[model samples]
Target: MARLYDYFLGGKDNFAADRAAAEKILEVAPELPAAARANRAFLGRAVRHLARNGITQFLDLGTGLPAPGNVHEVAQEVDPGARVVYVDHDPVVLVHARALLEGQGGTGVVHGDLREPEAILRDPGVLEAIDFGRPLGVLLGAVMHHIADSERPGEIVAALREAMAPGSFLVMSHGSSEARPAAVERCTEVYRSAGLPLTPRDRDEIGALFEGFELVDPGLVWLPQWRPDLSDMIDFAAAGPQASLGLCGVGVKR
Candidate 1:
């Protein structure tokens, strides 16, 4: 799944199998590459927003293969001293993240699963870089759709929120089945065939994950509509239905 995402972002780190899978999925939804780029843009915007609002610590859950505009890169742009920890269960992602983040002050990488918030919350790597006592940003960018209902993704988010301080923020963007159900269905099947499940949830289902967190301005909306800069608006201005396929928002813990 990580490698496939890398391919979508035009990175060279993907394998032929991943390319094949991505191509197959694209056959069903050719506008997906644009969506991927838009999602990354949303992530950058969210990180910057959190940083500008005095969020000094960040826990980037399910951090995928290293790419441009990383959490630390975006956050530090606002505050040079901002601390960030990248977490992912994949060994390859961990190795790459460590290699890239090495010697970079105020940053750490941990090999952890998003499904197990308890382990991540207690992980020494996370604890070292993130102070749970203070407000922080939890970034769940385009990763929650992989967790099926059976896995109780809402509970996973609730656990993270429980650990956050009052002013902490949860910045996330998730795939939605509402925009293009047929395209999403086809893509979900492709991911499942690759042993990675995709379960795009509805607005209410995604909003439920932020039970204790109050959504900031704009609330839960399509990716392009959430505080879009001029470029973001221009990019999706002429795009197809895929532009609305993702739901994103930033919420603060009450």
Candidate 2:
């Protein structure tokens, strides 16, 4: 999935098999690449927004294959010393992230799963870079949907919330079953046939994921609708025939 996502983002760090699989999926839903870009675009906006709002610590869950606007790069732009810990279960992702941060102080990567919040929280690398006593920006970008309902995603998220400080923020985006239903269904079918099960939740279900936190302004909205700037709007317009299938928001732990 990581490699496939890297392909979706037009990154070069993907294998031939990954490319072939992505091409096959694209044939089913031609707009998928556009939808994927929507998530990437939103991440830039969300991280930049969070950083400007005084978040110096970031815990990015499922950090996938690194791309142009990494969380550390965006956050560190606001404060050079901003600390970020990228967590991913994939060895390739971890290797790339680690190599990228070899000499980069205040940024690190950890091998962890989204389902095991406690393990992630206790990771020495995560602990060293982040101070839990202070506000932290925990990013769950487009990862929840891949988690099966049987994994108890809500409980997993709740555990992470419980560990956050009062002023901390939860920056997240999840696949929505409500938006572009046909596109969503087609994408889901292809992914499932590829042995990847998707569990896109409805607006209400996605909203419930942020239960313990107070949503920031323009709460739980489609990708294009969530705090988009003029450039973002222009980009979205250019990426025509796209589905705004991702529901995203920034929520404070207050």
Provide C-alpha RMSD values for all models, in order. Answer: 1.1, 1.7
lDDT of 2 by residue, 125-193 (tens): 889889999999999999999998999999999999999999999989998887668877887988988
Badly placed stretches (over 4 Å) of model 1 are 240-244
> What RMSD value applies to candidate 1?
1.1
Q: TM-scores of the models, in the given order? A: 0.97, 0.95
lDDT of each: 0.90, 0.87
Error of 2 at 29 (Å): 2.1
Candidate 1 lDDT tens digits, 9-53: 899888888899999999987777778888898899999999999
Best by lDDT: 1
- Count of backbone clashes for each model? 0, 0
